[model samples]
Target chain A: MEVKLSLFGFGNVGKTVARVLLEKEAFFRERYGVEFKVVSIADTSGTVWLPEGIDLREALTVKETFGKLSAWTNDYEVYNFTPKEAVQEIDADIVIDVTNDKNAHEWHLTALRDEKAVVTSNKPPLAFHYAELREEAEKRNIPYLFEATVMAGTPIITLLRHGLRGDTVGRIEAVLNATTTFILSEMEKGLDFDDALKEAQKLGIAERDPSGDILGIDAGYKATILHCLAFEPITFDMASVKGIVEVTPGEIERAKAKGKTIRLVATIEEGRIVVGPKEIPKNSPLAVESHENVAVIKTDLLGKLVIKGAGAGLKETASGVVSDIVMAALMMR
Target chain B: MEVKLSLFGFGNVGKTVARVLLEKEAFFRERYGVEFKVVSIADTSGTVWLPEGIDLREALTVKETFGKLSAWTNDYEVYNFTPKEAVQEIDADIVIDVTNDKNAHEWHLTALRDEKAVVTSNKPPLAFHYAELREEAEKRNIPYLFEATVMAGTPIITLLRHGLRGDTVGRIEAVLNATTTFILSEMEKGLDFDDALKEAQKLGIAERDPSGDILGIDAGYKATILHCLAFEPITFDMASVKGIVEVTPGEIERAKAKGKTIRLVATIEEGRIVVGPKEIPKNSPLAVESHENVAVIKTDLLGKLVIKGAGAGLKETASGVVSDIVMAALMMR
Candidate 1:
């Protein structure tokens, strides 16, 4: 089976996805009996479409050298071909959205309208329009998977949906955001909030304007997505949000003195989603290491199942998106 | 779609599976659009086969009251009908083997030869004959699923196979046996090994003769199964093993004083399988609560992923088996 994919976004995660796909092409074919081809790539600069499949190695080199897809010397690049146009025009089986674009949902809807499956690592589309987008895909009998949205490539969503299918989930306590967890863990090491945030930025773990992460919106988006998937469809606004700004180093020290750790935890239970800095026992599963995410799902049948792993990283997020793409391709077959 | 099932066991896990299936019948039908009819149940006493579908509630009541399917005061019970006869003569789409019968692999082979999918919570079959059983099912294009074999309902196998499909796994450190973990945790709390064994037996966590669990053979079987799934196939005899018989309370206390916990850990890496009591940081993910299992998978792409949950419980194992049944039904569709 040949699966053609159109990726929207050429940032670190998108570029990493292309690299993984290219690197694992033969492995995928031999293991899953499927060949994945990137039919189009659309970024802020422009879109590059090739029905014969875009040269991912060349695209990576072009984007890295020139910082734009349209700068490719090849004639396949089109300056005005927007993401929406790429979704509508490209003859692809699945459309992958790794962009932070607010209007990425529109492209997702357009792709679903064209009866193509959508796989995304972008949380906004799911955190905001889960029901609408999910219904669109369901109506078309297509997949709209975002396994990377919550905890990168940890497979929490798959565990909840497939592994624990008939089990009733009671509560979920999670450390969802890598940025806040990293900051909080650093703060536990006696680093002040400002210094921790600066270190996160230097490591590219946080953005230049880290308001989304510091303010808990990023974790809230993830909480919303998780709540929607595990329970019901919930918009970001429905979640009560709190961040790590108020968690001072003194407070972290105080918590540590009591054998506890202050972590930005997300609690989803009884249709209520809450994201805030909470003090958990240092030995609890929710108190994971720096930058790692953990979801402690309390199910009626299986008790508490903790899934902990890398919550952020270019390769991790790309791994998640590519897995989603593989599942989508298998579903198509 | 209706999926016919033949259950080959009537112990705790098998009975729990029946109860769960009966309770979740409507849920499975409404969710997966498949009605699962348990057509036959073969136990030590005899076999009960109903062509249309066995009345699970009545079967449960009869088994509880009479202690044997053959003792049921109904026309369906057949005293002379062995498990082999049931597998060969009965019409079932999927055969579920939850027995500890050493020759359960033969029934699985027969099921595969008849082109029926196989789901099992039995570890002996896979531990001793993984390649043979797997090849048989693969040749017949049938699913020989054993999600419940290792960590009961933790879904570690699925995580390695499907969740981390394209990623390369580096090493796996797992606390796979609940009996030893419970014993060790009890020993850490000042109980002697014999006292802890008695407590575990009283709590039904360990068998009367728990040589397998205490001698590390149980964990060895699970480790062998995990190794075969994550890497190449290896029987239980190919791995090095050490049980928990020698870990004294003094030793556990010393480890605790050093902020470490003694867990019967299974290490599978570089084609080597080792099961023994390893001292790890008390704060590590592998140092889970009593009766809990944790699998720390170090993948090339995702770094380390830890999955922790109930390692042994009737309901948890039932959940894993039923989920596999659901997946098998979906695949048949």
Candidate 2:
């Protein structure tokens, strides 16, 4: 089976995903029995459209060398095409969205409407327009997977969706944002909020405009995605989010005095979805180290299942995207 | 799609699986778009044959009350048929092996040869004959699933096989046996090994003949299953195994004094598969509480993925079995 793909966004995560696809092309073919080809890739400048399937290695090198797909002289570049136009015009089996662009969901929906499967690491598409996108894909009988949205490549979403099938999930507690967790851990070590944020940003774990991560919107988006998958469908607005921006050094010391540490935790239950800085026992599974994500799922039958791993990183996020691509391709078969 | 099942066990795990399947019948039908029916169930005494579908609740009640499926008077029973005969005679879309019988693999192979999917919580079948069983199922293009074999209901196998599809696993360190973990934890609390074993047996966490749990054979089986899934094909005999029987109270106390606890840990690398008592930091993710299992998988790309959950218990084991059944059913569809 040949699974052709159109990629949206040529950012770090997108580029890493392309690199992984290229590196694992033969492995994917041998293991999953599917040939994956990037038919088109839409970046900020333009779409590198190749109906014969883009050479992923050359495309990645071109983007890295010139910072734009339009600079690829070896390919026919559609300079006027946006992601929406690329999705509408490209002949592909799947559309992979790794863009942080707010309008990524439009192209995602467009792709699904055209009966193309969708795999995304982008949060907003799922955090806000889950119902529309999910319904469109379901109506078209195509897979719409976003495993990397919540916890990079840790497989929490797949675990909840498939592994725990036939079991009732009671509640979910998670540390969703690695940036907030990293900052909180640094704060526990006596660093002030601003210094901790600066450290995280310096480490490239936080974005230049770190408001989304520091103000709890990123965790809120993840919480919303998890809530929709584990329980019901709800947009990001349904979740109540509180960030770690107000956490003080003194508060960290006070928590330490009680053998506890403050973590930015997301709690999802039957009727409640909350993301906030909560003081938890230092030994709690959710009280993971810096950059690690943990999810504690309480199931009626299986008790609590705790999963912890690297939640965010270029390679880990790409691992998740590639895993989802393999799944989507297998389903396409 | 209607998925017919032939159940080949009636012990605690098997009975719990039947109950879960019965309770979740409506949910499975509505959610998975598949109707699951138990056509024939072979226990110790004989086979309860129901061509249409067994009344699962009634079957459970009969087995619990009479201790044999042959005592079910509501339907005709095959008195002389063993599991082998049952697999050969009865028609089913999948064969669910939850039996501990030494010859269970024979029936499993028969089912696969008959082009029936196989879902098992049994360890010996896979730990001893994984190559033959897996090859048969692969040749038949049917799912031969054993999620419940390693860490019951934890989703570790699925995570390795599907969730981490494109990534390469470098090593695996796990607390695979809940019995040993519970015993060691109890021993750490000042109880003798015999007393701890008796307590575990009293709590139904260990079998009356608890040699498998105490001698590290149970953990070895689980480790072999995981090794085969995560890395390569190797039987239980190929892996080095050492039991916890040699560990003393003094050793446990000394380890505890060092902020470490002795756990029967299974370490699997490329060519090394070792299961025995090892002292690990108490704060380590693999140092889970009593009756809990944890697997720390170090992947080449995703760092270490730690999964911890109830590794043993009737309900948890049944959750794993039913989850595999659902997966096999989806594959059959």
Per candidate, native contacts kept equal: 0.62, 0.80
Give candidate 2 regions above 4 Å deviation. A74-78
List, in order, the clash count of every candidate structure: 0, 0
Q: What's the C-alpha lDDT at position B110 in model 2? A: 88
Model 1, range A1-333, lDDT digits (tens) per residue? 898998888999999999999898888898789999888888888888888988899999999999998798555757577788778778999999999988789889999989899989998998999999989988888988888888999898778767877676799999998898888888888899999999999998899999999999999999988888778788999999998898887899889999999889999986899999999997787887767999999887788788999998889888789889999998788
Model 2, B186-233: lDDT tens digits are 999999999998998898878899999888898899999988888778
Candidate 1: residue A185 Cα off by (Å): 3.2
In candidate 1, how many Å is residue A195 off? 4.8
C-alpha displacement of A279 in model 1, angstroms?
1.8
Specify the CAPRI tier of model 2: medium
Pairs of colliding residues, candidate 2: none
Report lDDT (Cα) of residue A241, candidate 2: 89
Report the Cα lDDT for residue A214, model 2: 89
What TM-score is obtained for chain B in each of the predicted models?
0.98, 0.97
Error of 2 at A310 (Å): 1.0
In candidate 1, stretches whose alpha carbon ends up further than 4 angstroms from where it belongs are A74-76, A189-195, A248-254, B139-141, B189-192, B248-254
